[model samples]
Target: MRILLVEDNTALADGLSALLRGSGYAVDVVCDGVSAEAVTATENFDLVILDLNLPDMGGLDVLKGMRARQSKAAVLILTARGATEDRVRGLDLGADDYMSKPFDVSELEARVRVLLRRQAGLRSSAVHYGKVSLDLNSRSFSADGTPIDLPARELGLLELLFLRAGKVVSKEAIMQSLAAFDDDLSANAIEQYVSRLRRRLAPYGLTVKTARGIGYYLDRPTEPA
Candidate 1:
């Protein structure tokens, strides 16, 4: 999943970025609200972690801007403002969830999972495609009831493909979903990941099909006519 984290504290942002990236999410960090607004306007994100105390603008105003732009990304308010009134205002302004400072890392991670899953309209912690199964909670993969280990990037690619199985996903969309703003990921790199994943999944009757000049899609093996 792709996430935009807006926070002014460098240390906190770095820590959270590492944590989320370790969890297989593509995270972009911005310290000010204006940058947040600009990024949201241009790029797509699955989630936004906004802090109310931005330098250029209040996080609430940023939230308003996001809604004004008709952004469908789920917003999670993570701020030092613990006032009930602030929370009410944020929710009334369309924040999906709110978390105060001094929060537990585990709880924050759990909330992130919940918000992302909710945004995707997924109810279960696991998703299945034919013989391939993905455990959302653990980020593990299994084929035909046997476990398989994959690199983090490959796993992220698989998740994106599985979520939109049967639909043609463009390379640009995959790059946006799998890479952060600062990530030096290129189209060639994406092709490499796809190739590796294709090889890994082919043994289990799964296929990652290419659309020639377009992108790729995930599917089961074709049946004989």
Candidate 2:
């Protein structure tokens, strides 16, 4: 999934960006609130990590802009202000969760997983497709209860396809979900990833089906007649 991280602290932003990317998310960082508002308006993100102390504008106003623009991405507010009113106001303004400064990175990561899963209408951390299962917390895949190792990009592709299992996910949609702001991910690259995943999962009776001029979907192997 993709995340938009808005913070003015360069060091903190760098650390969080590295952490999220390493955990299989495409992250884009912007240092101020105006940029945050503009990017959230234009791009699609699964989650937004907003710092309320932005230099250009207040982070709450940024959240307002996002909601006004009808962006449905889950918002997690991060601020040093731990007052009850601040947390209540942010929650009232559509923030999904709030985290205070000096928080644990591990907890932040866990909350991120929960918010993303909630956004996807998923009730559990692990989702299954036929004989395959994906563990969102561990970022691991399994086939028939056995672990399967996959590169990060392929794993991301599989997650996207598996989450939207029956739907035809367009190349454009996949690119948006998998690529960072600066990354130039082409349709050809998506095709290659899909091909590799197909080969890797074929033995397990899982297939990714192409919709010809449209997109792709994950398909279960046909049953015997």
Candidate 3:
């Protein structure tokens, strides 16, 4: 999942960035509310992590802007303000969840997972596609109810494809989704992943069709990969 993090605290931002990265999420950090507002308006993110105490603008203004723009992405407010009024204000402004500072990292991760699962239209953490089933909560997958082991990268690749079946996901999009945000993964890396995914799906009667310079589309053809 991709998340936009708007936090000015360098240490906290860095720590949270590293933590989310370790949890298999691509996160973009902006120190000020101005930049955060811009990204929230333009980028299609799965969620936003907003801090109320910003350097340039108030976090509430950012929330207002996002809600005004009718952004559908989930917003989680993380700030030092723990008052019931503050939390109520945030919720009234459309923040999906609120967490006080110095909170447990596991709680934050759980909230993030819940938001992602809701966005994915899954009642449970596990999502099934054809004979393959992906358990987002456990970070595992199985084919035909049997254990089909996949490396981390391979599992991410499959998750991206299965999450948006029949859609034409560009190479750039795939790279951003599968590669860690700070990782210097090249376009060739995407090609290698695609090839590997195709080979893996071959046994399941699926194919990742290269769209002749456009991108790739995974087709579960009635025939085969």
Candidate 4:
């Protein structure tokens, strides 16, 4: 999963970025609400870990701006403010979840998983399409109930494709989704990943379609019982 972390605390941001990256999440960090708003506007992220107490602008405005532009990315409020009113206000502003400062890293990671699962319409960590299945927790794929081993990047690629099943995903968007703050990926790299993913999924009636001069989309063929 790709995440946008908007926090002003340098230490906290660094720590959380490292932790999330270790967990296989591509994260981009911004120190203020202004950058948060701008990034959320243009970039496609699965989740946003936002701090309400920002330097240039309050995180509330950033959340509001995201909603104003009809962004569907899940927002998780992570700040020192833990009052009921703050929670209610953030929810009303379209936050998917909220966590207070000085929180447990494990709990934060759990909440992030829950929010991501919910956003992807996945009741649990497993996503099923035709005879193909993928377990997010295990980071494993299967075809016809047989285990299929995939590299970390390939697994991430398939996860994104599965979540957006029929929707067209641009190369630029795919690159951003799979890339970490430090990793430099080119368009050809994305094509290679897509090619490998397509081959892996083809036998199970899952196909990745390329739109001329556009992007790719996942297409699932009907499976006979």
Candidate 5:
């Protein structure tokens, strides 16, 4: 999932960015609320992590602006302010969840997964797409009732494609979804994974299409049983 993180503190921002990236989330970091609004308005994001304190604009204003424009992406506020009024205002202004600062990254990640899953309409921790099913809670995949063992990275890739099934996802977008900048993408890495997935799904007649100049999409045709 792609997330826009609006944080002003240098250390915390850098740390949070690294942690989220490590978890296979495409994250864009903006230190100011104004920039957060600009980016969130233009790009499609699955989630937004906003810090109430920003250099130029208040984070509440940013949340209010998003609501004013009718953007429905899930938002989680990360702020040091612990007052009940602050929480009430943030939630009242359309923030989906609130987390205080000095937070646990692990807990943040769990919440991120929950919010993203909610967006995808996945109730259980298990997610399915095409002919393959994934146990998100267990980090495993199965096809044709047979278990398919995949490396962690490939599993991450599969999860992403499954979430956005039927839509052509771009290479740049895929790269961003995969990892942080420091883990620079390897040449033909995406192609390799797609090829592997296609081969595995061949028997099921499910397909992953490559739009040559564009990107890839997962499509499956079902027959009456």
Candidate 6:
């Protein structure tokens, strides 16, 4: 999934960005609320990690602008304001979840999973397709009960494909879901990942088909005659 992280602390932003990317998420980071607002207005994101103590604009104002523009992206407020009133206000202003600073990274990851699942209308973290199964929480993939060791980037690509399943996912969308803000992910790199994944899943009776010039989609194996 694509996520926008709005935090001004350079160290914290770098740490969080690394953690989220390692966990198979495409992340873009901005240090101010103005940039956050502009990005949300122009681009699509599955989730937004917003900090209320932004240098330019209040985090609440950014949240309000997104809501006003009818953005459905899940918002998670991350700030040092741990007071009950602050939490209440954030929720009231359309924050889907809130976490105070100095929280554990594991807990933050768990919350992000929940919010993404909720946004995708999914109740389970394990996605099953034909003989393949992937556990997002555990970051494991298996084919016909045999464990498949996929790298982080491949796993992220598979997650996007599985989420859409039969639907055609554009190359741009795939890139957006797997590439970080500063990563130099070219189309050739994407093709390499797709080729590798296609070969890997073929043995499990799944196929990733290219839609000519459009993109790729997962074709589930049919029942035997």
Candidate 2 lDDT over residue span 1-225, tens digit each: 999999899999999999999998999999998899888888899999999999888999999988888889999999898999999999999899999999999999999999999988898999988778989889899987999899989998989998998889999889989999899899999999999999898887888999998889998654322
lDDT of candidate model 6 versus the reference: 0.89
Every model: Cα RMSD to truth: 1.9, 1.5, 2.7, 2.6, 3.9, 1.9
Compose the digit string of candidate 4's lDDT tens values, residues 1-225: 799999999999999999888877899999998898888888889899999999888999999999999998999999999999999999999998988878998889888888888888878898888888877765678877799887878878888888898888888788888996678888898899889988877767888889768889898666532
Residue 40 error, candidate 1, Å: 1.0
Instruction: Please identify model 2 stretches exceeding 4 Å from their true place.
Output: 222-225
* Predicted candidate 1 versus true structure: per-residue lDDT over 84-158, tens digit per residue: 999999999999999999899999999999888888789987998887788888778998689988998999999
> Can you rank all candidates by TM-score, best first?
2, 1, 6, 4, 3, 5
lDDT of each: 0.91, 0.92, 0.83, 0.87, 0.80, 0.89
Model 2 TM-score (2 dp): 0.97
Per-model TM against the reference: 0.95, 0.97, 0.85, 0.87, 0.77, 0.92
Range of the 10 consecutive residues with the lowest summed lDDT in candidate 5: 178-187
lDDT of 2: 0.92
- What total of clashing residue pairs does each candidate reach? 0, 0, 0, 0, 0, 0
Instruction: Provide the lDDT at 80 for model 1.
Output: 92
Q: Would you list the clashing residue pairs of candidate 6? A: none
lDDT tens per residue, model 5, 118-208: 8878888876665678776455778767898766567667677777788888887777666543565763898898888777667666677
Candidate 5 TM-score to native: 0.77
Model 1, C-alpha of 60: deviation from truth (Å): 0.8
The prediction achieving the highest TM-score against the true structure is 2
Give the clashing pairs for model 5. none
Off by over 4 Å in 5: 137-140, 144-157, 166-196, 200-205, 210-216, 221-225
